[model samples]
Target: MAKRNRKKNQAGFVFPAPLAVVLVVLAGFSLVYVCLKAKTEALGQEIKALESRSVQLRQDVVREQCEWASRLSPASMEQALKAHGLVMTWPGREQIVRMRADGTIDSSVIPEVRPPARYARVDRVVMND
Candidate 1:
């Protein structure tokens, strides 16, 4: 770009009209490009930070699950039962009650709960062929 000589009183050179306008436009574009580049870099940094946090959280969850599983092993459960002095036994025949296929419960079992009137027969009815 050619710079024209200014008047003797002026300190700086003057640019032609067309050249000045072009220079102004180029400067505006440069400013916009710099702002956009900075924004893009900021967003990239934020994404990297979030990804690192997500990975750390996942690792923490896996570690916690492993610890939980180790604490609930069969041997640990047996030791806990012995520590509490609790006896382990199977249910007796009298403690178990058999259910009948009919709507009425087994007579051997007391306090039979009869089904509601609507539930007496659940067979579906066909309509319109």
Candidate 2:
């Protein structure tokens, strides 16, 4: 009876250690799959957000171009200049200066006809009491 029991136990019986190892391997694979799925979903959400932001940026660019177009019209420019109280006039022949290809003034211009300085000296009056 003892010999028969030993033969039955050793014949085609599954061991707990191999079964546990297989279960652990399957669990590890499942964990890795879940992690990859989560990462893919995160990347998809980021792509969607960036696409929306790009669309908004394109709309903003269109709006700015339209605004600039209106601002750049001749009438609009004239209005702006008038608002700033500036007077535009044609320069006289003596006031006009020509430039050469080398960036020097043309020899035909008189040396005595120098353009007005950007900032002139202001004379101050002093009162001695």
Q: Which ten residues in a row have the lowest lDDT in candidate 2?
A: 111-120
Per the 3 Å backbone cut-off, how many clashing residue pairs does candidate 1 have? Answer: 0
What tens digits encode model 2's per-residue C-alpha lDDT throughout 2-119?
4566656665757689889999999999999999999999999999999999999999999999999999998899899999876566776777778889998897875465667454
The C-alpha RMSD of each candidate to the native structure, in angstroms, is 17.4, 7.2
TM-score, one value per model: 0.53, 0.56
Best by TM-score: 2
Off by over 4 Å in 1: 1-14, 81-88, 92-129
